[model samples]
Target: MLPGHADFALPAPAAPVRLNGRRPIPEVPQMNGHSEAPSANEVPPANEAPQPTRSEKPAEPIDVWDQRVAGALAFLRRRLAGNYEVDDFGFDPELTDALFHPMLRVLYRDWFRTEVFGVEHVPVDGGALIVGNHSGTLALDALMLSTAIRDQTRAERHLRLLGADLVFRMPFVSELARKSGATVACNPDAERLMSQGELVGVFPEGFKGIGKPFADRYKLQRFGRGGFVSAALRTGTPIVPVAIVGAEEIYPILADIKPLARLLGVPYFPITPTFPWLGPLGLVPLPSKWLMRFCPPIPTAHLTEHADDPMVVYNLADQVRETIQATLLELLEKRPDPFGL
Candidate 1:
């Protein structure tokens, strides 16, 4: 004890308070010096606004159209700045995705009402040769086929097409073709693309298939010398046979003007129902329901040694031709009316 508080004594402790035979809860002091606590079920005063629960909070709005516009503008800026990549074959994937594919998607989806089947047969990775029947007079089937592959497959693989020499000879068309992943149709290019694990697309039927009259619509023309088969074999790439229906009906060729075709240095001068009669307006393709089916891939890995064997190449080419023909017939049966929904 200190000298000043020597006489001070500790106060006696208060007895414990109980209510309802249990320890009493201490009251909470309020700002007004009141020791009463609010009840658990008490409601706020009428003057006070109710607080919003977590679920009742407003969410920030998102404008999808605005976002798309902004994205397109940015893509344009990048393109103008030359800030994009192009492969050795002159394939500009960015341009293909942003420009070419979007434009073709409109034709592929709304105009043609294209449907794809057996897309799973296309490998996610590695080289493959896709041989398809060519028609539609303008090679529109190739564009549609490329669009279908991108849309249906899980990986959205780009198909490197083999274009004719005439296609590469044109001024504006050549640039577009190269940018869209097309190279000159030759064994060296085909083998190179496949060996590098690119999905290469080829129309072995060539001009014979696309230039045929509507009378011979679905009848496939001769697949050239099986050069595509030899290329696939050399690269040890799988060959995927594809059948395309409805392209023939799009620009039904009534006749071929041989003299005019010769004069213009073109393979054929097609005389469609509306072509010369309708003038520029006739260039528009008719709305035809398109069906594309990819057949099971024929493995060439085991036949690499027989790449130069003419007999082996012939048999494989025949098999692919037969598969495509059978699939085309099946698709035709399914779509009885070319323009049917």
Candidate 2:
């Protein structure tokens, strides 16, 4: 007898039961010459199979951590074997999707609590220029914007950013920039990318927009030379004006150290509330509620011949700048508090 069954005992048969070739079935009690079913309180016969109790549990689920580890190993193996491909512009889509985007998503989705709108205006395929306001001292808005488009869009298109020459001047930074699909901000590069049906992003305000004093936040800076407009016109690509809020509050520049900036051969050296005083800890961006809006695309296909026209370029650039400014104000109204949940 089993240990748990010590208190239980099976009743012995009164008469010898015979089964020549078939299994023996439990005999039911007879009442008035008719067979009666067992009562609810009655115990089943020893020959019957036991039913499962309510305490029994289902099988355990697979470990997601194990799957992630296995996937990471496979990715590493592929990278080690040189099995990945990069485009002519040194853009590695696989690396960008697998590695870079996932890391940025934590900041984009959770830390900043970003909200995106007007993704429908982004074309599923073909060329388009995304023009956005620049801020957040460190250019983190650019990364967030790229991540946003990829996450929100149906096709998950990559935004080819046009970075300042200073970014490519550094060694490791240049390689990472190229792999992440960023080139120098130039008309030739922009035109080529758009011609290839790639979505190119440009910040016309340059360092001036991001390095502006905190008091001047959300104010539109002068778009340099309207070069982005000319590029769009030359490629006949529509320009999608985007406005980003909350980035202004992340690293508000209280002052600028021009001497330090010149010494480092960089743009304005910002002095934020925490930065340089808090040292390395100051690098962490504040948890601000972010709002991004992509306005309707301004078609430039009809202005292809006017790509070289200064007036046409200036007007288009001004139009895009105004659209972004208006959208920023609207988004600001929607998000009353910069740090509100």
lDDT of 2 by residue, 253-332 (tens): 99999999999998999999999899999999989988787877889999999999999999989888888887788778
Query: Per the 3 Å backbone cut-off, how many clashing residue pairs does candidate 1 have?
Result: 0
Q: Tell me the TM-score of model 1.
A: 0.81
Best by lDDT: 1
What is the model-wide C-alpha lDDT for candidate 2? 0.83
Which window of ten consecutive residues has the lowest lDDT sum in model 1? 14-23
The list of candidate 1 runs beyond 4 A from truth reads 1-66
Lowest lDDT 10-mer window, candidate 2? 12-21
What's each prediction's TM-score? 0.81, 0.81
Per candidate, the number of residue pairs that clash is 0, 0
